[model samples]
Target chain A: MTIKQRTFYILRTAIKYVSLLIITFISILPTVSTVITAFKTKEEYGSTNVMTLPKSWTYLSNFVTAWKDANMGLAFRNTFIILVFVLLGSIMFGAMLAYILSRFKFKGNELIRNLFLFATLIPGIATQVTVYQIMHSLGFINTMHGYITLMMGTDVISIYIFIQFFENISLSIDESAIIDGCTYYGVFFKILFPLLKPAIITCMILKGVSTYNEYYMSNLYLQNKSKFVTVSTSLYTFTGPYGNQYNYICAGVIITILPALIIFILSQKQIYSGLTQGAVKG
Target chain B: MGKINTTATKGTILHRLLKWLRSGKGQRTVIMISFMSIPLLLLIIFAYLPFLKMFEFSFYNMKYIGERKFIGFDNYRDVLTDKEVMNSLKLTLYYLLGSFVQLALALYYATMLSFKTKGGSFFKGTIFFPYLISGIAMGFMFRFFYTRGFVLDTVLSWLRFELENLPYWLRDKNVNNMALVATSVWKFMGQNMVLFIGAIMSVDRELYESASLDGANRWYQFRYIILPSIKTIVILNMILSITGSLSAFEPPYVITGGTRGTSTFFLLMHNMAHRHQKVGKASAMALILFGLILMVTIGQKLIFKYGFTDSNEDISQKTTRMLRKQRAKEGKQ
Candidate 1:
């Protein structure tokens, strides 16, 4: 190669790394500074600007205060309970619906498909007024089970995702199973459910993340914050007395994000692939 | 020419029903009914019922309780004519502009990292981290980050800019809405990039090698080979971002409390419903927004279907195929 080509390649590589570095820094800017502020003393936060380092890195009071005052234990517990039920219920219903839709030649199949198809078009926020009334009428306000049922009931996208997966799993398997005297239920649970793992994961990732981070609905329905303080709405606790205290607020924010961050880091590979699959299918 | 069952009783309704339940056809019928009922029931309770009720509620004057009088189009009139309600469209435009920048940035980074870039995974993880953070936390974090003489201004001061010259990020109407828009971009930009990367990865690598051999520069390869190949997912994402920008919330609601004129359309509807107790007007506003979104989404779908006919396979199918091939490769090893 000529010296000119080598020089050009070198310059391109440099530019690539530099641009990546800058973009990465910019993306992490808010969180990194929040982490810094979360450990600082109140005096330091006030006197120094946000970028400055604290004298000691082991300041644990803010975290403790945020955790107790925000009732994050209850928050995490509530979110965990919600995620468990939501994921299980949505996956089961979604899989069953997909199975029936994919294999069954039924009278109302087209209607059911279009029902879900039409449901996606209705902006959820637009319909909250009446949904609130429905919940109220059922005496479901300020209840955890009501929230779970609502979440499980509203999961249309997961059904579609599961249904898309069913198309890839060949029908010959089901036929063979039926010939082997397997009931339709056996064919689904014994033959098909195991194969739907990837789809389940995809749905879990999408559904789990949304349910975890769901703020507006949770805030509206879970009015008894002490009883149903989800991580998403838990930080609202700090917006009153400690609202101006940036250190405590930042600490509370960190407390909420830590779980998501950890889960994200550990499952980055699955998350990326799942998100891709979801995007394409969705 | 069918044989009759000797043990079956046609006269007794109960006996015939039990006989039917014992048959294979009966089991299939039972399974079908039971399976179909669950999701269908869920859809009715959560989606359809509430949707119909919302439509009805738009025409009534009511709060959470007491006297839901039918007001006949008055709420719709107010929703259309109210200055604060309509002013949300102007704020939405800022987010629309931000989304474009978000898309451009996402595309740029995806093109760069889609190939064999060093430490690509680390960079991708860092960029995608913010997306996992809850909206409420992110709002609080950014509130701290952008507060006067805070992270943003402090960083600027280190670059030799005077601290006094910096405008209040959350105040000062000229830049406040843009500040809120920037927060949305910060959160979603990585998600868009990852989608683009996945689409780009599914493209045949041989195309790039051949293009390079034909003396194609990076720009030429990107514009012709990469962009055209991943066009479908990109377009789909573009449509999603458009809907997203139209329904922008969370940032202004969380960070600035939609104060100093940063309220997006969704935020306005929320305030109308909750703060002002204008449930009827809010419902009308929500329906109007939904109608606008539906029109835009359907129009885009039409354009996509007819406009981009060259692509044969769906992107999901491609990604699934790629995964299967990877699994096959791994199995052999």
Candidate 2:
């Protein structure tokens, strides 16, 4: 309660808050500037610095130009198709694998699990050179379905999450279902699968975000950018000829970010918990 | 009649096999095999098979196509001795340093926000927003942000600094790597912070209250209580982040195209394979990078195990013992 001690405590608290504020500002600075720039016309962008607020927030020409020029329509469509197929295929495969490995006493059970554990240690990028050749020879180059198939192949995290979840669900559920004249397939699809909603959400958020943000493989394997343009790769349409066109580029960038931003804002709770749970299990 | 029936039944082996297929044991076998086969197959084809192929390709001089020369160990030697490859690896150290900086910041903020703080959730969300963004968009955003006379320069000018005084963030060799690493920290630090926060929140609250009842300060409490509790997760996160930095890509590849000496190992390997058509060399470089990452991961675990041998020490007793010593000294005085 001494004044000197009180002053020092106040100073320390002030520093902590101020430091957090400064970092929060820095974290959002780029996105905020881009948003500001996206609303500017090319002439306005040229006349004003990047930090300047636009005169009118409703300038729609840059967005229109970026949309058409960048072929975002095709990009969104391709990404949508990829997400749909990959999510469905991977979730099914992951849940099914987790069920069998955990529920049934089978031969080579431990061996299959070790195969995946060892696969995790292998750096994925290291093997991509060879993977590229495999895809090429299989005539999977530039094909949307091929990309989806490739995506479904990497389901390690989902399986890990599902397996962790399965440990908590009682085996009596499966036992009773089977005794009630249910096949293993029915026990899974009708009973256990529906109960896996939380785990599915975790996998969905983690896998979905990564898939949506995946640019390297999207750019590399899906080579025909025009036909196979993903939302992530579509932004690169501005890289070559219109590299300095910040107004349109920012517009394009905003367009790409809007969906993810909306989803994040709505599902912040699930995403946070899901991420923590996934991290612990993974 | 019985002999004829037996002979007929024994003769129909295919029918018996079909009958068994409909039985319970057959279904179990079928389901287990079918369920396990798909993921295991995918892992083999996409992961292990390619890993094996990459291993084989490292020994031969080849490209995406054309004739392959079995120049055993030559590619490996070149990868080891190449100055450019080694230099590209040295850039990883900058990222590693940046990542540790990131962890420290995350820990500080996690500690701050773990206690009662204003708008903690809002700050967490804002910081974590970048992680949700695609890497390509971040590259685009920072490209604009760091351009000369752009966002960064304009912001600096407000602080009474001249625009000319600032270096180009992505072009200047000295600061470019750091600049790229900053982008990564901005994008990823939030996630690490969240992880830390989650770990911190799970800690028993009464521990903090009990420590405060003693003459323990915040630093003592953190060092004795929070640090020991969250040690496993913190170390795990550190290992993961270090391994990730070894193959740092996206920022350099996207922003500067690995130009101006900003090329990290993966980006250089990418360029070598696709641009220069040196697949074998690139594969060798990849294997070498993997080995480096493996060594670093193992090295870190060893350090943690040997360096922190007091994993099972009782924090409360240690605090009380120190308190007892201080009281004894005060009594003597």
Candidate 3:
């Protein structure tokens, strides 16, 4: 290569590395700063500059105060309950509906598929007013079951994922099962359901993360904040105009994200693939 | 005689019912209904029902609980003429611009990281970690990060910038939206990058090898090979970003509470319904927003379908075919 070409190549490589480093620094700065602030005492937070190292690295008071003041114990419990029921209900119903839609040649199948497709186009926020009214009429407002049911209700994405998975699985399995005296239900539960482990994992990861991160609907529907504080809503404790305690708020933020952070560290591969696949298909 | 006749009729009906239940058609119907009823019901009640009601509510003047007055088009008029609503709609331009920048950055990074790089996974993990964090936490982090003399200012100070010169990120109307948009871009850019990388990785390696053998530089390979291969996914991301920009909420809602000229269309509607108690007007606004989204989506679909007839084929084939045709023409010349 000519000297000009070599020099240009070096310049390009330098630009790439420098830009990547800058972007990485920007990405992690918020979390790192929050971590630092979480460890500082109120006095330290006020006196020292924001990026200053705490006097001691072993301070636990901020976390203790945040947990107790935010009622995060109840929040964690509620979030867990909601997560378990919502995941189970969504997967079971989504898979069952997908099986029928993909495997069966029933009347109105096309209509049902189109309904789901059209439903996805309507943003959920656009329908909140009437949905709230419907919930109130049904006496479901501020109820855990109501929240879970609404969450499990309109998961067109997960259903689509399941349908795509079902399409790839061979029909010969189902045909053989039927010939061996298995009913349709028997074929689904006893034969096909076990084969859906990977799809289930993908759906769980996608649906699980969204449901965990969900705030708007949870806040609106579960209005009894003190009685029903999910992890997302628990942070509101530090949100009033008079409440500007960054130390405790930072600690609460750390507490709120710990589970997700741990999960990401442990299963980074699965998380990346699941997220990419979800986006691509979506 | 009457008792005997009644008994015979009852037995006949029972036998017919049993026969029907044993039939294949009946079994299929039962299975379909049993499996689909709950999901279908939920969808109708939660999604479709509310969607249809938005239209009905748009035509009537009502609160959450009260008598309804049949007022036609007034809510639409009010929504259109409202300065606050119009300003919020205009502010979506900032988010739209942010999203485009986000896509560009994501594409650049994905291109870089798709090839071999030092500590690629570590960089990937660092960038993608923010996407996994909850938006609420991000709101808090950014609210603090942007406060005067805080994380952002401190970092700038390290670079020898004076703290007094820095603007309060969440307070100043001029740069506050930009700050919020930056937070959003930070939070979501990783997901977009991963998506682009996935698309690029799916491209065949031979094309790159051949291009490299022909003395094509990195930019040339990216332009010819990666760009064409990932066109569909890029377009899809663009469409999603456009809709997302229009519905931008969380950052402003959580951090700034839609203050300082930061409210987008969704936030406006949220305040309209919950704060102002103008359910009718909010419904009208929502329906209008929905209509806008639907029009744009259908327009995109049409453009894709008609404008690029052979876009689905591999770009490498198209390039090579064009090259061969050009060579033949030159030979004739």
Candidate 4:
């Protein structure tokens, strides 16, 4: 390459690498700080000289307190229960809605599609009071069932994603099935549901992560302290009012996210497909 | 002949019934009308029913847990007259503007990533990593960054900025909301980038080539060829940004502990419900917040319709074809 061309190429390459390096550092900075701070003793954390290595590492005391004493254990249990029911219910309902919408032509097809699309814009918090009232009237207050139902049911985004994916399936499959005299219900339950596995997984992860991390609705609905509290809500009670415990707080944060991190690591391959496709299709 | 005719007619009716039950065309109608019964019922009862109830609750003098008295527009009057609420609203508008900046930045980064460059996959992956982390974790992360804590402090001191001299980000009322917005942007930029990148990638590259051949520069190609194509996604992102900004609870709730003295509209609603137990008034506030979001979204849709023309359809089709070819090449590697 000519000298001028080489100079231009070097400048472009340098900009790309330098910008990316800066971005990556900013993104990971928080996590790195949290990990390091978690190892310090109380005094070390609060000391004026915070950047230095802790005077001594206090091994796992924060983790223990955050896990057991701070009530994260109970929070973990509640989160698990919520995720299980919410994930299962949303996937089933969303798939059913998507299946029907993607395949069938009915009188109100356009109306139904518009309704679902419109429903997507209505912020969930907007209807919080009424939902609380409904839950209270039904005596579902402070119950796991109520928490799961509220978080998972009537999700428009998940249903939308499923519909987008379902639309891609060739109509010929349904055509042949109909020609073979299969009922619509039979074809949907037997053939179509199986074919929608990838989409199902996509909605599952999307719903699962959102539901798992959700705090506000759960905080309101699960009023009784002993009955149910997700990880985030539990943090309110974990630290006593006297002073905030940074170590335990860090531990709680880490503990709360560990499950999601594990799940993400295990199913890492499907994640990009699930997240990217869902975003694009959305 | 009569027997044959009768049999054929009977078979056709059965086939029609079967087709109604199974075909994708009829499936939406049947399924919508049939299975949608319970969900629709629940939505009406829970969603709309509560919103109506909220309207009712707002008019009364209601406490957290008590008999509500009928007071016509008194609560609305109070909410409107409260200087705190007004300040909170202004703060919300500021935060909303910050979110827009973040959204625009995300769009730019996403557009760059969508360009068929070498190492695009790695860049995209690094960018989207933050979205996987929860809001709560992100809140904690920011707390560490702002506070004098751990490794960041060392770097700051090395750069000759004394730790004690720098104002703590969360402690200052003026900068608290901005810092929260920065944290939010950090967490959300990745997700928005993914969405916009996907939208741009779905656009046809042929338009760019053609624009170039006509001696149009990169800026013109982006304006005429790229911007119009991603209108729907842009609109969607805007709606999400507005709603998400309005309903921001986690960051402020965690970092400031709602003592930032000025709250976002949703955070105010949350405090009313949780801290004060003003369920009735809180619900009213929530309903009002909902109305604001709805008005903005509808207004946005109207603006889009009036302001923008349909994207060039031929370019879109060509873009789809090019995207498929690109995907095929990736598959081989």
**For model 2, how does the per-residue alpha-carbon lDDT over A172-232 read when each residue is reduced to its tens digit?**
9999998898888889899999999999998988889989999889888998997999999
Error of 2 at A195 (Å): 1.9
Candidate 2's DockQ is: 0.76
Better of 2 and 3 by DockQ: 3
Query: Which clashing pairs does model 3 show?
Result: none
Give one digit per residue, the lDDT tens place, for model 2 in B1-333: 999998888878768877776787877877888887877778887998898888888888998879999999999899789888888889989998999999999998888888888898888888888999899898889988999999988888989889777888888998999999999999999999888888888876867776677656778778877887788788887888778888899789878899999988899888888899888898888888778777877787697778765442354455556656765786799
Residues B1-333, candidate 1, lDDT per residue (tens digit)? 133543333446677787787687887799998887877887898888987777888999988667889999999998888898768888878988999899999999999998889999999998888788888888888888888888899888878999788899899999999988898889999999999998888887766675676566898778766787788877877787777878888899888888888888899988888888888888888888889889888988798878867563443344445545655776799
Better of 1 and 2 by DockQ: 1
- Which sections of candidate 3 miss by over 4 Å? A1-5, B311-313, B319-333
DockQ of 1: 0.79
User: For residue B167, what is the lDDT in candidate 2?
Assistant: 89
TM-score of each: 0.93, 0.93, 0.95, 0.83
Q: Which ten residues in a row have the lowest lDDT in candidate 3 chain A?
A: A273-282
Can you tell me which runs of candidate 1 are displaced by over 4 Å?
B1-12, B312-333
Better of 2 and 4 by TM-score: 2
Choose the strongest candidate by TM-score: 3
B54-134 per-residue lDDT for model 3 (tens digits)? 889999898888899989999999999999999998888999999999999999999999999999999988998898888
- Scored by CA lDDT, what does every candidate get? 0.85, 0.86, 0.88, 0.71
By DockQ rank, best first, the candidates go: 3, 1, 2, 4
